[model samples]
Target: MENNSIWVGKLKKLEPSDYTMSILPKLRIHEENVMEFLRLSASKPEHITEILKMENNSILIGKVNNLIFSDYAVGILPRLGIHGENEMEELGLLAEHFEYISEILRMENNSIRVGKMRSLVLGEHAVEIFPKLKICEEGGIEEFFMVTDNPENITEIFRTENKNISVWIRKAKKLRLENCAMQIFHNLKFQKENVIAEICLSADCPYHITEMFKMENKSIQIGKVKRLELNCYAI
Candidate 1:
């Protein structure tokens, strides 16, 4: 019988074990079908990894595999609680799926931490609807400091009093920052130096504020200590 006909017949069998051992072999005879099966079985992490190692580069094979793997990783892996000590292993398998799916989906947003597979599906539609969704920064202290006090702007919020700025800065290094300016200042003295002067002296200045100074050079003193203090209070 033809491979297609064989696959059709196997699909009719309705048994996963039978499908795994019997139909899978025949379906894999063609690179395209093999890719398809690999994708459909993406929740089966071991199988998907094996398929990724295949040499075939056919567009259909790649596309279907990607779709299947993405769906399985993002959609299926989070729900499994298998028998025996394999439960955590199963979740680990799903985590690997999320990692691979994120890469295949060309997602650059490190903000969506994939400790589990469920988050994959959570963001899948957003990515499809807006490919730019992946460009968004993961939330952090800098983000919090940017748009706080606006009820509509808050999504996730964390606050710590007297937290060291350096510690937060270190944590931010592990996250993605999309088009945000970052700077650290040392030895800033409010008694003598103006806020504007301190900012001007700093190597890295916020872009928008710097632009305002450029457009109105005389209005903004380059190194006036008193003016800088007032501006700091306003912020």
Candidate 2:
């Protein structure tokens, strides 16, 4: 698409006028699998939308694996000259999947309201833009993500009781902080004993756990050395 010659060549071959036969069927369903290739192959081929809208009830359908609207459709909307916050609102009415729009925004390293970031099975990087994001108000921390790069978010989730207490327990163990993990375990409203034992086994520090045993053995050995010194001094 960067090359003007290739752009001219494709248009000359399809001749814009012949797009009905040459292009329209490719967008028939949500795969956009076809259009993904087509759009990147050509630059600013906005007329593709015209071909799509020409069909009966131009409203888009949700994809097979998707919870709501088609991700592929939301992605191409921007290329069709639909962009920005207000544009999102316009498309929001038609969209079955709001998460896909959030994903598109994430791809661009952009942010949106936490309400729009719902059904967030993906887009981990996008949600990192808060306290700008009101995730707790929308649902809770667990509603958005699981593993995060930020430790602050981990503490925030625990503080809000946004998930099962065991989640925070596991996270604290993962961070390898024994004292904090112990405190979190004590605070849990309900506890899973098996899971707690598993975390302790995984988190055990051999040196710290055996410190008193090691010191007692060293003192007994030190008494034998003191007896030897006394015997030499008497000789």
Candidate 3:
């Protein structure tokens, strides 16, 4: 909504408050909202350019299909909550055309692809979209947390990087990791005896499974026992 008055012109000048009901909904726009329209219209370059210009040439992010991996997108990625230039470099390696990203990662509508993503921040309802995320590699999602049942979903608590990874899946019934390769963990312990063990034993890249179930059975269970499953390789 940068310089919103320019877009609305006379309408915004005439009826400032009513413009929201008259125009914003048709454009599906709200200030401080994640520019999802960029994702939807990424395929059309002209439309993308037009939208970007309309938004005062804001950053490009979120499944920007078919567009070039230009400096514009790279510069704005950080604003979209994407961490690290290394992660953007990995994204650049995916394909020349950004559209190939969706095909390569098997992305679905509203699904998040965490492949090569170093940091992951999720809310309480995150587990609903867990199946949608394409997680690959050992340290793909190194930082993650699901705080209290409230909306104050913060990621700064107990976050360790590079040397060791700490994840707090509070009240998360099922936690699963797949296709982890070349992992090195100094302290890996399974917190509970009842925790399921389904890890690959790679002598070259040794790692351990640590599952902590702190919540009561009734609180965490989704009609089943709380479990942590990792289908890892070379870990």
Candidate 4:
């Protein structure tokens, strides 16, 4: 157990459980009292100590834990200068409050950019926040790999029959599926700069660019050729 004296300057400076024990009780003292104490707890640790002295520490900690990860707590975290509880939970909240988030709210944005598969499906505004390729990679409508926000920009040409991915990207350039990107090579702007060299030099991408590398023409290359695999082979 840590000395509560360490929490004299800022409640956020302490671990979440400790801070929750110290501050939730004070804020929860009044049923109407909500996030007002968050600002104070973040800025004045002595004030927190005073309140802690009056709380039933064990009871407060228990109660707070029961609600700390609830949706209500998600809104309060940003106010208290906290971002999230952990990687997965935070992503879900951030995906919900996409418009209000900034780069400073979190340390890493890579995983968040692609978003969890579940979030990409659920994020109502996810198309606006994530890159087309990233959104597709995370799980997106097959054909909309780029932007077209206005009504005038909506063209009858791209609207395919049934979310069924029928060579939409191939007709457009590459191929996309009903649910995700088959790959991004046909985006033109992001085509592989050295795919042939990378594939010839590395075996990891054996079928990734099979047509361009002509992996089927074993006479042109030399190696222990293994069985080919479909993208959805396991499924």
Model 2 CA lDDT for position 20: 36
The estimated TM-scores of all candidates read 0.22, 0.22, 0.26, 0.20
Of 3 and 4, the candidate ahead on TM-score is 3
The candidate 3 region of ten consecutive residues with least summed lDDT is 10-19
The residue-by-residue lDDT of candidate 4 on 1-235, one tens digit each, is 3333232322221233324635443332221221212211123233244343442222212101111221122223222312122111112221223323223234222222222222111122222223221222322222223221221221222333211222222222211211112222222222323121111111123343333343234233312222322333111
Which of the numbered candidates is closest to the native, going by highest TM-score?
3
Give the runs in model 3 whose Cα sits over 4 Å from its true position: 1-28, 32-77, 80-165, 169-172, 181-190, 193-225, 228-235
The sequence of per-residue lDDT tens digits that candidate 3 reaches over residues 74-178 is: 212222322112232122211123332323123342243333543343323231223334445444443332212321111222224311222222112233322
RMSD vs true structure, all candidates: 17.4, 19.5, 15.8, 17.2
User: How many residue pairs clash in all the candidates, one count each?
Assistant: 6, 3, 1, 2
Cα error of candidate 2 at position 201, Å: 12
* Candidate 2: stretches off by over 4 Å: 1-61, 66-145, 159-190, 193-235
- Candidate order, TM-score descending: 3, 1, 2, 4
User: Which ranges of candidate 1 are over 4 A from the true structure?
Assistant: 1-39, 56-97, 105-235
By lDDT, is 1 or 2 better?
A: 2
Task: Report the lDDT tens digits of candidate 1 across residue range 74-173.
Answer: 3232221111111010111122223434443353323222221111121212222112122112332221112111121111111232123223332221
Q: Which pairs clash in the backbone of model 1?
A: 193-225, 194-225, 194-228, 195-228, 195-229, 196-228
Q: After superposition, how far is residue 163 of candidate 3 from its true place, in Å?
A: 7.2
Q: lDDT by residue for model 2 over 48-136, one digit each (tens)?
A: 44433443223222121112112233333322311111111111212223343343444321122323222233222222222222222
TM-score for predicted model 1 compared with the true structure: 0.22
lDDT to native, each model: 0.25, 0.26, 0.27, 0.25
